[model samples]
Target: MDSTKCLPRLGGDSSFELGLECREIAKTIKTRKIKYFGHIKRHTSFLKDVLEGKIEGSRIRGRQRRQWVDDIAEWTGKGIRQCTVEAQDREKLRSVSCQPLEQGRLRE
Candidate 1:
């Protein structure tokens, strides 16, 4: 039970022969966020308000920070308003969220 033996070795032909591939962390995170947006949209709760950046507060006056919705909008290549409409349909949202960014746009 050697610890070194349990870990996948780095930069070797064996690693390739084993068919190991590096996961795209950013893509994975973005996909999960998109899925969570769908989940929030399907529910009737304050979480929706929070997700939409409607919290009660004043910002420190420099520049506005990006909202959670903003990332989803960019990733999905659709306006926030349109995303809201599409997110209402769970099956469609699931399909859109899991697709690669290039093909994730809502069908016209």
Candidate 2:
């Protein structure tokens, strides 16, 4: 798949690095998951921990934000919803989350 073509804007701004931007975009991307599109969701999460000092820092390098966005775009386009495995992440999610379909959706 041409990931570059499907890329959405990574939320980079003065207050934070692309890591923080990654978090915001992740939050936005999570919004489209099939079974939970309209539900409230977390944006930063791991990154939020970084900001809040609960964790040391994000392992994600700033240079990778674009690729991350592209990967998420592909996954979301295909209806694959990925959740962080932390117990809190599970609690934050909707009960019946959508998994990826083996075959692509039919189209005209």
lDDT of each: 0.74, 0.39
> What is the alpha-carbon lDDT of model 1 when measured against the actual structure?
0.74
Cα error of candidate 2 at position 45, Å: 6.3
Identify the leading candidate in terms of TM-score.
Answer: 1
Which RMSD values do the candidates have, in order?
6.7, 17.9
TM-score, every prediction: 0.65, 0.21
- What is candidate 2's local distance difference test score? 0.39
Please provide, for model 2 over 39-81, each residue's C-alpha lDDT reduced to its tens digit, 9 standing for 90 to 100. Answer: 2234545544442243356776566433222333353443223
